[model samples]
Target: MDNIAGFIFLCGLVLVSATQPQDEILNNFQQVTKLSHLGLEFADFFQNVTLSDISLADSRAPNEEDLLCLRDLTLFSNALKERKLWALKMIDAWGSIPSGILTGNRHNLGNYDECLNINKDISQGVTIRGKYCFLQTSLSAMLGSDIGALGVVTRIKTATCFPASCSAAHMNLFVSQVLQKVLNLDIPSTAMGISDASCQTSASEPWDGLTIFTVVLLSLMGAIVAVFTVYDYFFCKNHNELPAIVKAFSARANSRALFRIVENTSNPNVISCLNGIRCMSLFWVVFSHEYTGRFFAANLNLFNVLPWSKLPFASFILHGFFSVDSFFFLGGLLLALIALRTMDRTKGKLNVPLMYLHRLIRIVPILAVAILVYTKLMTVVANGPLLQGFSGETACETGWYWTLLFVNNYTNVKCLGHTWYLSVDMQLFIISPVLLIALYKWGKKAAAGIFVLIVLLSGCLFATMMVNNYSMMFFQNSFSIDAMSNMYFATHTHATPWLIGFLFGYFLHLNKGKKFQLSWISVWSGWILCLAMIFTSIFALYPSTQSNTPPLTTLEESFYYTLTRVGWPLALCWVVFACMQGYGGMANSFLSSPLWQPLSRLSYSIYMWHLFIQEMNAKSSRTNSYFSDYQLMLQFWSDIGITLVVAYLLYLIIEAPIGGLDNFLRPQKKPAGVQKTSSYPIQIVSDQKVHGDGPSKLKETETIAQTISE
Candidate 1:
């Protein structure tokens, strides 16, 4: 009995695999047949109707063959109509036939028109004689065998029922004829199919795609890699390595932390704009990295033809996050203006220590918390390796120390590779002030000329890199090169575009008296051009395709590398100029919203922390089966959420407190221009009379400086 049961089970598997259901095929046939009939009927209906009849000139002529085809299609309609009726009638007598009988083969019943007629007559023999027709019988007889599927018919009489017509209907008739020749039209006669019956004795089985052992091994390997990656991201191997991070987040918050910058002003515009740009840019960075990383890992060639194959731009319309040079340029400009203003107002004697102290106060607390949280999650929670798999690449991984120290400018550290723009900006922080001091003394024209030269130099350098096909360096190098030679992009390479922003700011400040011409045409045109530049960058740049090497087409290569980096920046600069000129209307309403403020506030922390979160999520996905399909999207959003939470938390706990500590560490000192005044209210007189001086000559300068700083 057991042997018999096993044999039956094997037989059942074979029967199931050998055939597909008849209902699905029948439904498809009916659908296609109906559509063909509908097309034919519409043609006939329009034959007698003219455009003039409906007050519109009908340009297309109705095809006669279309009418004939519709008439012939009625045969299948009639057959289907009969089948439905027969099934209803046969319901009472069901199961009289063998239980295992197959029904799929009976589809051939529609093959002959005469056969159908005969069957109809047989079924209705002495009951009644009724005319069976659909559409028009006369029209049906005109098209011989061209109405429906030809293979469906078994005899000449059936074929004669529908013939092809030679008119506007030729297209439909041609399609109908081809379909008829392709379909199966036979009914099953056997109690069981030969293949299904054979399964009882000789069962069949499908080959397995993978063995159990192999699956287990793969799972194990995945777990190990995930574990290692989680460990690396969270734990600093040594205290000395991350002291600033520890101190900032520690219960006893300290003054010395990472990312310090000083400025002595409460200017809302400077602060708000910088913060907003940072947050928005970081979001863009995360999106680009997450999407692009997945795309490359999957080895998709969706945009193989396009050169600018990467994130944001290649993925969709809003993907221009990959084109994040806009933020860097903005920061550079703001920094330059602030620096220049300080110099001019202070009679060329800017307090460097005060500036550094202020910056340190703002930056360190947030930096510390970010490092701590990221380190904890990566090390303790995830157990991932530091730098993940980047341990092997000496050139690339060597920059991690520099990154932590925020000395990436000197060491070229790029722990968060995509975040190199931050490092570049930090380096700019040191250099821009000095440059601003020079601009105040040397004049705006000279400064602008120097900026132009730098831009040209950047362009030339990009040209050289592309010419040599430095694919590895282009993609891999994070932060060692001078701002001019940063390989990843044309904009953030060193401080090249930053310099442009600085110069623009300087010039804008120097020529402060000129009224901005907010002519509607120029404003709208500038806005339109900014939009066009963004779109062009997307279409022309962001997609990446697998190539043994980068393409060598000079025209294609030069165009993308230069235009996306160079042209887009200039276009953006123009946009900024326009906005400054008017600073109102739709553009202002959009940019100055309450929503933008928070994003700007958290932008820096988000930038610092997002990548570590993304790495964690990516590892988590491998372990969790639920995210198998939507891993990429999940990881992207997860990174964003984590970054926000972490940033806000750090902002409150570390950033806010660090400000106080920073102030304590470096107490506010006297301004360079301040001098000791006479202590007595009754000052000894000049020429034997009490003489009093008005407000210090430095009042206006101090006011302006204070305003600019704020």
Candidate 2:
């Protein structure tokens, strides 16, 4: 025991000593080296000086003799300690320091042979201040060179012992153009800060090797993912088999799991109001897409003011299409409610395969038809040849593959434009069933924790953006768009926002179970708060004060970019709360209208096909194609009109067929009585078909299975 204690003490002592101050080590070593240099003339001079006499300024006359003596003393002192030697070298390489400051003396003789002659002169012995001033200027220049050394120089007019004088920009260009070709890091030119001027004009030269590798790698990965996605979308689906878990929850003792919510029609006005909001949210999405390219432009005239054009409130109004956020929030809430109803009806298994299938059937048909027309028909009409424009930029078009495959965001770059949002929405929906299943199993606490984690992930993403010099990471079309596109796909950053929306929906659902007394005071206060958040989100999302940079004004940007990105979605839950509070009025009347029904029914289809129509219309000569490079943009509105008709037709044909097929497969039987509360124990069975991995062990699997059996 004593020996072990001794060993531990020795280890602790050694660890402490290792971390001791560097100055103590230097001081101890100097004693031995300084003793040997006592006899040397230069060393004698340095040794004679008391510790208090050390200073930057020269104490001697302005001749070369004094300068030589100073140099000799410096060399002798440097030789006494390794740390001193390094420090002296750093001073010299970084440009000189004041001798007076080091030695604690007040010599003012500034005319030294080695130092550059500036206008300042010190006839008296060199002062510490003068020496410090010279050191400051020299150090600044040295730092500039140090930074420069990191780059390459086309021409070397002079050379120095310190390499910082070399051009850093040139060195970076050489590394990118030459070294990277051999290394294959796939480092983007944007990441390296490479300029266009230094690179060669030829297409081959501009690409370097990294770009080509990136394109090939991404294409390969995308193809692999597509294979899995297509399989999951098609063959693995069993709308008829609706999971045992879902069946357990949806059914009463008499019925089954996975049931749909039948909105309370007790108050027609309230239902109407909620429906109206749904339609408005859909319109907001469409308008948001249309306005995105217009209002953000600094040069455009808006409301006759372009503060960027001296237009004040006009820009603000245009920016009000901030409604895209509302759409997102509304969509999440509705989906969550549906999931809740489904979970409650079914025992615990929601049919994920059927969910994906429903989405695929609804989105694909229109997209496929659109892709064919744009790629085949449009190409032949414009290029005067079929399949001629099927490669490169000419191949850019709205398509079914992205929506059908739940990869809308992934293919946004390939689509004409303004398609990323639609893609992101659909992608969110594709994964919703899986999320709902988790929510059903784990409950609210786990969902909230996941949401918080997602928000933190978004924070880290924002931090990355700040570190990378505010390079756009969202789907904005700009010089930084390429960088944005690359980083946006990082699941850690992008997918978190959707999770945030989901949690808000879940939270609202949890709250709805509790009843609160509705007083005049509370109702009015709720109204005020709802209006405030709406306006706050409006100002927050679209600050028209400035335009060259930052999506919002300084104040609004903080709230919009930092707060509202998450807050606005949560704020949207209050709309439902408000409608529920009061059953009748203007809000209810507006919502109950026939206008709301068609839009709500077609919202998903509209979101899917809107961009395709826009792109096609932009290609039309009648829309004044020459007036806008975005020929597909004017066509977007017209396409929306055409697509609505087409999508409605598809809903009747394509979507209805699959929905009907699922209904037929799982035909409703006679209503049964409620089962015992303990009968349906929640059991989660991993979809091996989806996970395509090993089995998960669970306690009481058989009992849980029997409980959920149809």
Candidate number with greatest lDDT: 1
lDDT of 1 at 19: 64
lDDT of each model, Cα atoms only? Answer: 0.40, 0.39
RMSD of each: 25.5, 25.2
Going through the candidates in the order shown, the clash numbers are: 63, 71
User: How many steric clashes does model 2 contain?
Assistant: 71
Weakest 10 consecutive residues, lDDT, candidate 1? 690-699
Task: Mark the regions of model 2 whose C-alpha exceeds 4 Å error after superposition.
Answer: 1-264, 267-274, 291-321, 379-404, 416-438, 471-479, 482-497, 508-514, 541-559, 583-585, 592-594, 622-643, 650-653, 669-710
| Model 1 CA deviation exceeding 4 Å by range | 1-279, 293-323, 364-377, 383-400, 405-413, 471-486, 489-492, 511-514, 541-552, 622-635, 665-710
State how far residue 135 of model 2 sits from its true place (Å).
Answer: 60
Error of 1 at 265 (Å): 18
Give the Å error, residue 171, model 2. Answer: 42
Candidate 1, residues 1-710, lDDT tens digits: the string is: 12112212222322342364777545533433333222233333333343333211123554554443444334324433455443222221111111111211111111122212222232422211111111111111222323332122111100111221212233223323322332321212121111111011011133234333334533453454344334434665644554443433432222122222322132222322233333344455566666544432311221231343433434442334334456545655655555455555457776666665566456544544444344333433442111223211343334545545555534443444443444445555666556766777778666877667667867775676566554321332221344323454332353455566667777667655465756788777877878887676655433333345454454565556555666556765775555445543565445434455445434455555666666665533311112122555676776787768865555445443444345344335456665311111001100010000000000001121332233
Q: Which ten residues in a row have the lowest lDDT in candidate 2?
A: 687-696
**Per-residue C-alpha lDDT of model 2 across residues 1-710, encoded as one tens digit per residue:** 12212212222232233476878645533432332210122223434454334422325333553343344334434443343432233223211111211111111112222121111212354311111111101111222333232122111011001111112342233334332333344334333332222211101124435445544643453454345434534644564554432222121210111112234353311223445664565555554454443332211122222232224333333444345455555445545644564466576666665555444443454455444444444432332101123332343443545543545455544443334444556666766767777787788767876777776866776666555544331223222654445444433444543575567657655664455568777777766777786677555334334555554323333334546556555555555566655523465556555445445545544554554444443322211112122532453456668878755544443333333334333435535674322221111110000000000000011122122222
TM-scores, each model vs. reference? 0.49, 0.48
